[model samples]
Target: MSSLKLKRFIKDSFPDNNLIIVSNREPYLHNKSGSNIKVEMPAGGLTSAMDEALRSTGGTWVAWGSGSEDKNNVDDNDRVAVPPGKPSYTLKR
Candidate 1:
């Protein structure tokens, strides 16, 4: 099924509540490219679906951050507001 359909289903399934996705593998991987950090999203159906869902619902994604630059982006509690410009979710590492 499409991400739009999944998002709709998720919203319908849990109305008046927030969505939290917890996983061992992080959706984004931060790597050091020279002096800058590059964020990479792995290619996977589940990841894509979750990204779409979170983007649409403005939810929280909780995962273990194993990236080299993950710590650099997080706050005291290891939480970071993602997507830079227009943050739609909180990434809790």
Candidate 2:
């Protein structure tokens, strides 16, 4: 669905409630390739499917922080807003 429609649906269906998605793997991964931090996309459709839905709702995704550099990205609260440059949701690793 388009983001507009998704947003409207979320706004109507879950008003005053927080939207959260918990998964075994994170949508994005961070690793140290030599000295540079590289962000890697998972090798499946799950990320693509859930990303927009979460983004539309501005939800929180609780997933395993399996990446090597995962700790370096989160705040003191251990939450990282995801999709990097155009962040729209919180990721609690």
User: Which number leads on lDDT?
Assistant: 2
What is the clash count for each candidate, in the order shown? 0, 0
lDDT of 2 by residue, 8-81 (tens): 99889989987888999998899999999998878878778788888888889999999999999999988998
TM-score of each: 0.84, 0.90
Give the winner by TM-score: 2
- Runs in model 2 with CA error above 4 Å? none
**Colliding residue pairs in candidate 2:** none
What do the candidate models score in CA lDDT, each in turn?
Answer: 0.84, 0.89
What overall lDDT, based on C-alpha atoms, would model 2 receive against the true structure? 0.89
Residue 66, candidate 1: how far off, in angstroms? 1.9
Tell me the TM-score of model 2.
0.90
Tens digits of per-residue lDDT for model 1, 8-82: 888899989899999887778787889999987878888877877888777899998888899888899999887
